[model samples]
Target chain A: MTEKTAITPATHTVPPAKFSHGVRKGDILQVAGQVGFLPAVEGQAPTVAGPTLREQTLQTLANVASVLQEGGASWDDVMMIRVYLTDTDHFAEMNEIYNAYFEEQGLKEAPAARTTVYVGLPKGLLVEIDALAVLG
Target chain B: MTEKTAITPATHTVPPAKFSHGVRKGDILQVAGQVGFLPAVEGQAPTVAGPTLREQTLQTLANVASVLQEGGASWDDVMMIRVYLTDTDHFAEMNEIYNAYFEEQGLKEAPAARTTVYVGLPKGLLVEIDALAVLG
Candidate 1:
């Protein structure tokens, strides 16, 4: 059996529950759903990036990227992403930001497949995103 | 380019939008979030298995497994599962059903890493489940 590893980036606090922020086994890496919360600050409660969907969306992507990088992967290795939005109205806005972000990253592989769903979130958060990456 | 294949089992309806039911690129297969709807029948709208969470949860797992099987992977190949439950009170109930189901499957690999979150689902549907599987 291949060894399994839990990944926690320096930017993240210990997850609130028993799960890792990300886990990699063999050639595949799975990032837990990540929200727009800013990187942990000493002695401060977790906070969202801002009130706007765009702000939270970018920060959530950054947070998911941090976990992927910590697991020795990158956006280019990502094969899929799942976005959770609290409100249905934010769908188009998220895609616009999502498209621009990946285009800027200039991924070498095909754009990762994605699924988005409307879901409830903790108070004040608008989006949550997670990723799956494969590496050679 | 490594080939990317979209997976749609005969049991499922064509997804409403551009998204595929599941997507496989190389060794990885991603099953899109699935709710408790029973397999579609001609001329009938999609419907949940039952009103009870246990009934819905079981059907939801079956639905996810159908896509995994379509991609030539099984529960044993699954590396991670993210479960979205509509009601917070149903977490323990869902876990009980989840544990019994997997235990009955008698998987060979370590139990897949799982993360659960509270989320909204379509009316009368209590859960949504998705899986990531890695094949040799």
Candidate 2:
């Protein structure tokens, strides 16, 4: 009986919140909620931050992908994702970029089962994403 | 090759106002952010909803447990849990009740690799809980 190993990122800003970045229990990798967190540029306040919401979101997912790579996995290993958007109006825009990422990754089968919702986010950020990847 | 599964509670309220009560994939159960949700008492708002934060927290965990049971599992199968509190100051009070629950459940080891954080929650709710459980 192997237990899931919890993975906490060394980059202080990767999580950008109280939660840990990812936890690997057995064959499962659970990525915590991520928002527009750019580790190198996270210090800049959103007000002063130049990256658009879409840009930041991509950057954050990139960071998550970086972690997955470190753990010997890829985006195709991801089986489920939960996206929280501060504005549902941006769902199309977010999906546009989201689909592009998957397409670029060559995930032709069922994209991960997803749940998207509009919510009030802290730090007034535009979006937050969390995921579950199976490495079994 | 296996596809992950999502779990919905049969007895609990559907589509919680703030977040999903819980989600399950395969043998792993990933509960969404849950705060002071009282299915027993109807129409109770997050503010002043629970008689106490401890009570509310317990109710929220109970809800999570119910969903696990509905999926043919139990609390003993829980692998990880992340708890968010509006105020970290309540750690002591919450811990008392939290410890009591685990003890009652005969949890010999720790109560799942756990993380607790203080954060701003919706509806002024004091606490919210999310969890992951794996059936061996």
Candidate 3:
């Protein structure tokens, strides 16, 4: 049996609950849902990256990248991604930002399978993203 | 490199978009978000199990199990599950049904790691669930 290891990088924000930021069992790494909020300073609450959907999406992806790197994986290792948006109307705008991020990372040819759905988020949050990556 | 194969079970409803019911690479199987709707009758729209949250949650679990089985997995192989409910008020009701199902399946000792969040469903759907399973 493959044992599960929780990944908790110092750079990533501490999770509010008992869950870890990500968990890895063998080559597969499953990241927990991530919002645009940055890591809090100990006793402080987490803060959002910005007010707009585009800004939050970018920060959320950055946060995901941080977790991926800490787990010894990269964008190319990601097999699937699930994006949850607070408003369906923001879909197009969110996609534009998401697409560009991958393009900038030079992973245009091997993009991960993706699924997007509209969901309700806590106040002041616009987007949440989670990923599953398979390493070599 | 691992090759990805899509699983499309005849007993499950056809997805509305251009995605497969599940994708398998190596021993890992990733199933797309599944709602409580039953398999369609040819050209007919999919029907929900019932109007209540408990009924819909049970059907949704059934649907997830069908996809897992089609991909050569069972409830015990499931590693994690992410549940999206339209109403946060329904969390307790949903969990009762979810826990009972796993218990009845004799998987009470090691239930799949779970994360539940509130989200918006298209219509007539109370819950949506996605899962990851690993085969031996």
Best by TM-score: 3
DockQ for candidate 3, C-alpha atoms: 0.14
> What is the C-alpha lDDT profile of model 2 across A6-105, one tens digit per residue?
4555542533222346656567676766666555445553331234666866865776686576556678888877777767689998888888877887
- Segments in model 1 whose C-alpha atoms lie over 4 Å from true places: A1-78, A88-130, A133-136
Using lDDT, give the best candidate's number: 1
| Candidate that beats the other on lDDT, 2 or 3, i.e. the better one | 3
Best by DockQ: 1
Least lDDT summed over 10 consecutive residues: which range in candidate 2 chain B?
B40-49
TM-score of candidate 3 against the unseen true structure: 0.63
Angstrom error of the Cα, residue A129, model 2: value is 0.8
Task: Please give the distance, in angstroms, between residue B81's alpha carbon in candidate 3 and its true position after superposition.
Answer: 1.8
Q: Would you estimate the TM-scores of all the predictions?
A: 0.63, 0.60, 0.63
State the DockQ, from 0 to 1, for candidate 2: 0.14
Query: What is the Å distance of residue A16 in model 1 from its true position?
Result: 18
Taking chain B only, the TM-score of every model is 0.95, 0.81, 0.94
What's the TM for model 1? Answer: 0.63
Please list all clashing residue pairs in model 1, or write none if there are none.
none
Give the runs in model 3 whose Cα sits over 4 Å from its true position.
A1-26, A29-78, A88-117, A120-128
lDDT of 3 by residue, A1-136 (tens): 9899998877677787999989998888988898898755677778898899988999899888988998888877776788888886787687788878877887624355455778678999989999988886
